[model samples]
Structures are given as structure tokens and as C-alpha cells.
Target chain A: MQAIYEYLFGAASFVPHGYCLAWRPDLIAIHALSDGVIAVSYFSIPIALILLLNKREDLAFKRTFGLFALFIFACGVTHLTGMIMLWEPYYGAQGMIKLMTALISVITAISLWPMLPKVLALPGPSQLRAMNERLADEISDKNEAQIQLHNAYSQMEAQVVARTRELQEVNQRLKEDVQRRTLLEEELREKAELLTATNAELERFAYVASHDLQEPLRKIQAFSDLLKREYENDLPEEALQYVLIMQNAAHRMNKQTKDILTLSRLSWDSIKFASVDLAEVVEEVEFDLAERIEESGGKLEIGDLPLVPGDRTQIRLLMQNLLVNAFKYRAADSTPEVKVNATLHERGAPGTGGAYVELTIQDNGIGFNQEDAERIFSIFQRLHGRSEFDGTGIGLAICKKIVENHNGAIEAVSSRGEGAIFKIQLPTSQPTRRNNDAGRNEAI
Target chain B: MQGVTKRFKVLMVDDDPEDGVLVQKAIASAGHKVDFQVVTNGAEVLDYLFTEGRFTDQSRAPRPNLILLDLNMPGVDGFTVLKQIKSNMDLRRIPVVVLTTSEAETDIVKSYDIGANTFITKPTSFADMIEVMKSLKKYWFDSAQLPVA
Candidate 1:
């Protein structure tokens, strides 16, 4: 133990290394000064490595760099020992530092070999610059696309209105014919098909709306279109006029069939009750009518509405009908504005009735006589000549049926010039829902 | 149109001859030179597509790029025809457009559920019909998407 201690720390019994240059002052000074400069420079390299490691905690080879710093610092101390050995010859400590530096250098070298691929994999500056450029280009392209879409939509809207007006006014004589006297024998036809589709008790109307009568009318319109396209220049003017009338009448009848089909489908299918959000329903209706509203230059104001237990589809139809009627009957000079507002009212008779929602749809348009309010909802009832406004006249009637399906009541009041107001009251929840059987699937 | 070399083939299944003529005229006026063929009933359509029963002659029954279907027919209805065509591996790629007078939502939903590519209500006016069919021309000319073998 004594010998080992001596081997590691003893500095006695040895001459100073200054003897190598024969104690020349100039040579001694040069060796000490050179060692001093080399030690300081070595120490500075490790300090710089340590500073770099501190700044870049995310560096891939952090431990290896730390090991390099330790070894480089050991090298600096070894060089300092070299400067000191000139006088004191601390050979044992010098040997110890050199041995530690060798161990650290070997470990750092081993660590670096394994990390070569990882260090190389790090993204270079030019690659990072390209990625940044690509990301910036994508953002700008997406922004440009959105702007172009917005522009195209408004342009298309303008084109649609202009083209439709031109099509309706294609023939001066046809325009006069469209305005002629009144609707066809719609009342008589309605007495049969109208009651058939709405009255679930009537089975024959279901067959009629789905087949036979509609097919012939559809064919007539199709062939008339074909004739007009093929023989517009060849046919006599009178023949072409007859063809136009046939096309017009057939088209109106087909629309009536569609309305009847809608009613019949309601009668055929069972209503599915759900948590119907009236505000959302009104928003959807507004979206569907957005184009029409734009063409009419109209506005719709919707208010907060309570959720009711009813069919969402039926509610949508009811709102659509009223809103369409409002737009269709707008005063030629005025911009139409329709407002939908609702309130949740307290239950009636306490235990006897559940809560109900009362809704009011009001419009600014050409209104009808108060006396005809009741008649307007009847099937096939039209308040104006087809010339003034073209409609199947079944819109209000469908609205009435939808209201009825929800176990509700709908009524309208209007003066000749004052716009109409439709008041609706429906139970907040269906009473039959408590049985749970209705909630479960059952065919109508 | 720049690279096209042959006329696009469209097969229409309709019972009404007038409707057939109307669609043919509409396609012709759209400036898409079409090899328009019409079959009057559902049975003929099945035969025309599968080359079975009356259309055994392969040369007479060339595969169409598109099919225009009408739901109402005398024998096997359009729904059956659509189901058969969509289920067959050989015929499933041809796009089917349901051209019908039925505005019933059930028909629309059922046609889509059965794999009809498009559903359109039969138009009432020549101008509107042209407008309705403009997209059909667009679809026909989209050669990259065409399943033509």
C-alpha cells in the first residue's frame, strides 16, 4: 500500500524536467510558455463544448459531447502538469490524468461510432427551408381557392335569375296564354285525388298518385318537349302554340301530382317523434330556400324556439310551406321579410294537458281577404289568378295536414293589404309516448 | 373532347317511346355525339346488359358507358333491374342514373340504397330538361372516371 501510494502521489527523489534543456533560461521559458498556451487553448475547447451542450439540450449526441468535454478538460490539466513538471516533476499525477483522458477518449469514441447515422439523419438547413416554403405555399393556395369559390357562387346566382326570366318570356303569346282567365278544372280533379292522398281511409287515391294518371301527363310533357326541340322551325305557328298549351297544362298537373304524392306519403308512413329543435329546423329551411330568397331579395328572421317532441321532417315541411307561400305572394314592389317566432306556454288544466309550444310565422307581403283565410287551406283553393302567381294552391293544405299530424292546430289571419300571420300550437310531447310502444318500431 | 375518338354510348330503359326520343334529342343537342339506344321494358334491359335471354348475340349488345333507368315498367321493374346490375361483378362498374317521374323520397332513397349513381326527377320543359341533362353530359365525358372496359 505504501509503494502504491508513492507511485500515485510521490514527487520526491526526482529531478525537475528543466534539466532536459540544460537549464538554459531561454529554452526553459519557451517550453513553459508553449505548454501554458496549449493548456489554456485545450481548456477553452471543452468550455466551448460545454456551452454548446447547454444551449442545445435537444442535441442527439449530448452524452458523447459531455464525455468529450470531460476528456478535453483532462487534456488541459495534463498539459498544465507538463508545464509544472518543468520545475516540480509531478510525474505520478500527470500519468494519472493521461490515463483518465485515455479512458474517456476511448468511451467517447465508442459512443460516437454508434451515433454516426443518427447525427447524419438530422435535417440540414436547406431541407428545412424547402419544407417551410412548401407549407407557406399550401396556406396561400387554400386561401385563394376559398376566395374564388365565393366569387363564382355570386356570379352563378345572377346568371340563373336572368336565364329563368328569359325562358318564361320566350314567346309574347305564351306569356299572355299563361295569364289567361284562370286555373284549369283543378277543383274537380282535387275532389278525387286530394281527399284520396290525405284521407288514410281512402285507398284508391294512393294507387292514383303512384301510377296511371301521372304517367300519361308525364309522357305528354316529355313528348311535347321533344316536339318543340325537334320541330321548332318546321311546325306551323298554330301547331306550336297548341303544343305549348299542352306542355303548360301538363306541367301544372304534374306539380299537383307531386303535392298529392307528398300528402299520400305522409298518410302512408308513421310519424317518427323525436327531440325536434325548431330553430335548427328553421335554419335548414332557410338554407334550402336560400336561392329563392336571394332571387326574391327577401330576408328571414328566426327567433329562439323550444325543442318539441314531433317529427322533424314534418316540421320542416310545415315551415317550408309557410315560407314559400310568403315568398310567392310577396308584393311586386316590396322586398319580402318573413319572421318566425315561438314561445313555450304552460300546460293547460294542470294535470289534464301537457306543455305546448305556440309558434307564429308572420310575413310582409300581399295578403288575402280575411274571409278567404279558411278557404285558402282547403285543397285546390287558389286566391289569385295563375297570371299573378303560379302555384298548385295545395301548399297551405299540406301545411295544415302536417300540423294535424302533430296533433296541433294552425290558423291564419290577414287583411287585403296587410301581410298574413299563421299561428300554430302543438303539444310539447305526445301523450302516447308514455306507453313506450310508439317509441318502439311499429308499422303504420 | 380533345382526345376523344369514338361516340359515348348511353342506353336508356324507358317504357315511353316519347321519353326515349326526348332524352335522345337532349343528348344530341348537348353536342355529345352519343350512340343512344333505347329498350322499352325492364326485361329488355336485363337482356341487353347481361347478353342473356334475347340479347345472346354479343355484337348486338355492346356494353354501354352509362345507363338511364326508369322505375316504372311492364314486367320486372327498375328496382329489380338495378339490383341485378349492381350485384353482378361484370356489370357493376357502369353508372346508373334513375330518370323517373316519381318525386317520392322513398324511391330516391331506395334507388340510392340499391346503388343507383344518380336520381333526377323527370323535367317538364325542354329548357329545363336540357339544364337537368347538362350534368349527365359532364359525367359521360369524364373519361378517367368512366368504367368502360
Candidate 2:
């Protein structure tokens, strides 16, 4: 070891260290200052590098930065050794430091060659800024889409709320309408019941009044007739004439009361509907009017008549009234010719399948004026004086009542000095009682 | 008239005196040998038929051959009287006729339903009343046979 050291420091000293440099005090001071400054700067550089490494813990290639810092420190130490050689020949140490610096330099250079591509592949500042700008743009577009979706959701919610409110209002209106209709129906039912009661009461009053009225009138007629029968010779001519007038008035009043009673009793009780042969009714009526027909020289002809639904008694009365009217209204010169005919017809709308039997009684008699046709059906409505006709003028009215009771209709067609036709239409099948009751209520 | 040697005793039950008098006159005019006795009200007629109250004397209230009843009265109307008479064994043999001013069909049907022998509506005129009475006399006193009391 001593030999090797002697070889490095004895004659192999390339520049005889400090003597070859011609070292003056000024040069020595300058070199020492320069070396001191470089040494300090180098140490400071390493300290700064360590501090930076500590602060930037994420710094890339940390091993390479550490190696560069160690090399620079070795160079500053070599400079310090050069300054020491001017004073003492520590040539061996100086040589060793220089060699160490050369070795570090060579190692740093070789390590840098392999790290070149890695450093070049890293992103530069401009490239990183451009990528950040693109990310910001994408985030902005996503935010815009989210805002549009939120707005659409809010609009749909608002429409749903509005539709729900509108439906609630319509439902409220429908509820009110249903309530109003129910109230109206209740009122109508009450009114119908009241009207039915009133009609029954009126019918009862009519029946009672007619019946009571007939009682007193009968007494007057009976007593008056008794007086006339037993004491006619005792009375003066004028008094006898007065008695005759009284008798006539009483008889007329009695007839009127009886006719009123018949009219009132038409619908006084429940009707029993049955199928009646109209031909049989006509025959019975003809039998009842036989004497009158013979006296008036009236010729009666009957055609085909149908069996109709009606009350048997009421139909007989209706036929009697019509026949009596025919016989009573005969012409003064011509023989009364009466013809009765019937036909079946469809009633109401065509497809309804409702049918009726129409009976037409045509007469060759002293027909009334057409204007009085409607008036003739009114009770006690006389067209001629008592001298011209001996009737209470209630026969047609009774006929009309009977026809209405059977759910039938009667119409008269006549002209002055012409024949009259009484057309009667009766339903073949009885309408329901409810329909008849409704019709009666309307008439009342 | 067969089996009518004695005059027919008729009891007329009425509410109105004028109606009762008129019925008597109509019967007389019908040429019937009838002795008519009038009771003013339906209750009095019942009393006479049962021989009770004011009609306790059997000789004065003899059994009538025919009883003419009026339906509408102040008390115990003709329907009740007829019911009572037909239910009693002693009075049921007498023929009861309903002679009323009521022309209502219900009255006629009810009278016949309660064992009335005949039903007749009182005519409004004296002539018509006489005719009806004549028919009644012909049917009851002349044609119809009566049970011996």
C-alpha cells in the first residue's frame, strides 16, 4: 500500500500539485475564496434539491435527481481539495477526489442515455392544458342536458296538477246535477200524489151533490103531480097552467140531475175491463130504441163490428146514447137512415204495432152545424129549443164520457142540412192502468 | 094476487119524512093493497124489527112482509139494519128490498151482497116512481111466494 501510494504521489504527479501552479498569496486567497464559494454553492444546491424533493414528493425520476445532486457535490469537493493542495501536498487525496468526480460524471452520462425516451414521453404543459379544456367542455354539456331534463320533469308535473284540478271541477258539477235531478224527481212525485187525491175528492163531491139534489127534486115532482092529479077541477085555468109549467120545470130539472149523476159516475169506481162484442151491444141498443125507430120510420143498417176491450155496461150505455141521438135528430121530411161500420187500423207510429178499432156511425138526419160539433159534447148544452126537441142535451156528453172511460175517443162530423158521422176509435187491447192514470191526471 | 088475502104490510126505513111520504103515495098510486108503516131512522127500524125500545108492543109492530131500506141515514144506516135483520132468525124470513136514491154501483152490489132480496133506485120523477112501484108490487105481491110467518 505504501508503494502504491508512493507511485501515485512521488514522480507520477503530473503537475507537481502547488509548485507548478506558481502560487502567490493573492492567487492563493482568490483560489481559496473561489473554491469556498463553489463548495458552498454546491452544498446549497444539494440542500435545495432535497428540500424540493421533500416538498414535491410527487416529482418524476427522483433517483435521477438524487444522482445529479451527488455528482455536483463531488465536483465542489474536488475544487476544495485543489485549494488545499496549494498549502500541503495532499496530492494523493486530490487525485482520488478527481477520479471519483470523473467516475460520477461517467455514471451520470451513462444513466441519462436510458432516461431520455422516458422524459420525452411525458406530457408537456400545453398538451395538459388542452386536455383540461376538453374535459371542461364535456362536463358543461352534461350539465346542460341535466338542466333540460329537470325542466321537462317540472312541466309534466305542472300539467298533471292542472288536469287533476279540472277533473275535480267537472266531478263537482256532475255531483250537483245529480242532486238537482233527485230533488226534482221527489217534487214531481209529491205533486202527482196531491193531484190524485184532489181528483178523488172532486169526484166524490160530484156524486154526493147529484144524489142529494135528486132527493128534493123528486119530492117536488111527486107532490106537484099528486096535486095536479087529485085537484085539477078545483084550480082555475091560469093556476092549472102555472101548475103545468111547474111540472115541466121540475121534470126538466130532474132530467138534468140524472144526466149529471151519470156523467159523474163514469170514472167514480175502478173499471173492470173485458172483451165485449160491439155487435151484441148494437143489437141491444136497437132493441131499446125499437119504439122510437118505428115512430121515426128510421132504417138502421149494421156492418161488421169488432170485439173490443171495454166495460160491458159502459159499452151498452154508449151504444144506447148514440142510437138515441140518431133517432132524436132525424130530419122532418126524410126517413132516418143510419149505418154502422167498423174497421181495424194501425195506431201510433207504424212500427209500434199498436192497433185500434174505429167504429163509424153515419146517419141521414137533421145534422147540426159543424161549428157546434165540439159544443154538442158538453153537458146540458142545448142546440134547439124544447119545442123543437124533447131532450136534456146530455146524450152526446154521456157518450163521450163512456168512450173516454174505455180509453177510446169519439169525434162528430156534421154540417148544417147534411148528415152526421160519429167516429169512435177504441184500442183493441187495454192500455196499462198506469198510462190511463197518467192521462186522466193530465185531463183533470 | 095469490096468497095475499090480507093487505101486504110494508115497513119503510128512511131518513127523510118527505121521501117516506112520497114512497107511500107512490105505492098507493101503484094500485097495491099495501099498509105502509114508516120508521124515520135506521135505528128505529131495527128496534121495531127486534120488538125492542119504543116498539115493544108486538101488536103495533107487526111482522112486515117487505122491508124497504135506505142506505144513507143519520145513524145505523140501511146496510147495518139489513145485516141485523138477515142475521136474526125471527126477521130473516121477511123479504128486504134496498130502495135508495143512490145510483152508485157499489151501493147496489153491497146491498145484494148483504142478503138484499131486491135492489131499486128511487126514480127522480113521480111518474117514474109509480112505474117502479108497480113493477115491485107485481113481482113481490103477485108473482113471488112468501114464507108463512
Which has the greatest DockQ? 2
Residues A314-427 of candidate 2 have per-residue lDDT tens digits of: 889888888787777876878898999999997741223478888998998889899999999998798888898888887888899888876678999999778899998887
User: What are the per-model DockQ values?
Assistant: 0.34, 0.67
Minimal lDDT window, size 10, model 1 chain B = B139-148
Error of 2 at A146 (Å): 6.8
Clashing pairs in 2: none
Which segments of candidate 1 are over 4 A away from where they belong? A1-207, A235-239, A287-299, A330-337, A349-352, A364-366, A369-371, A431-444, B1-6
Name the lDDT of candidate 1: 0.81
RMSD of each: 37.2, 9.0
Candidate 2 residue runs with Cα over 4 Å from true position: A1-160, A346-353, A366-394, A431-444, B1-6
Model 1 chain A: worst 10 consecutive residues (lDDT sum): A434-443
Best by lDDT: 2
Task: Tell me what TM-score chain B of candidate 2 gets against the true chain B.
Answer: 0.95
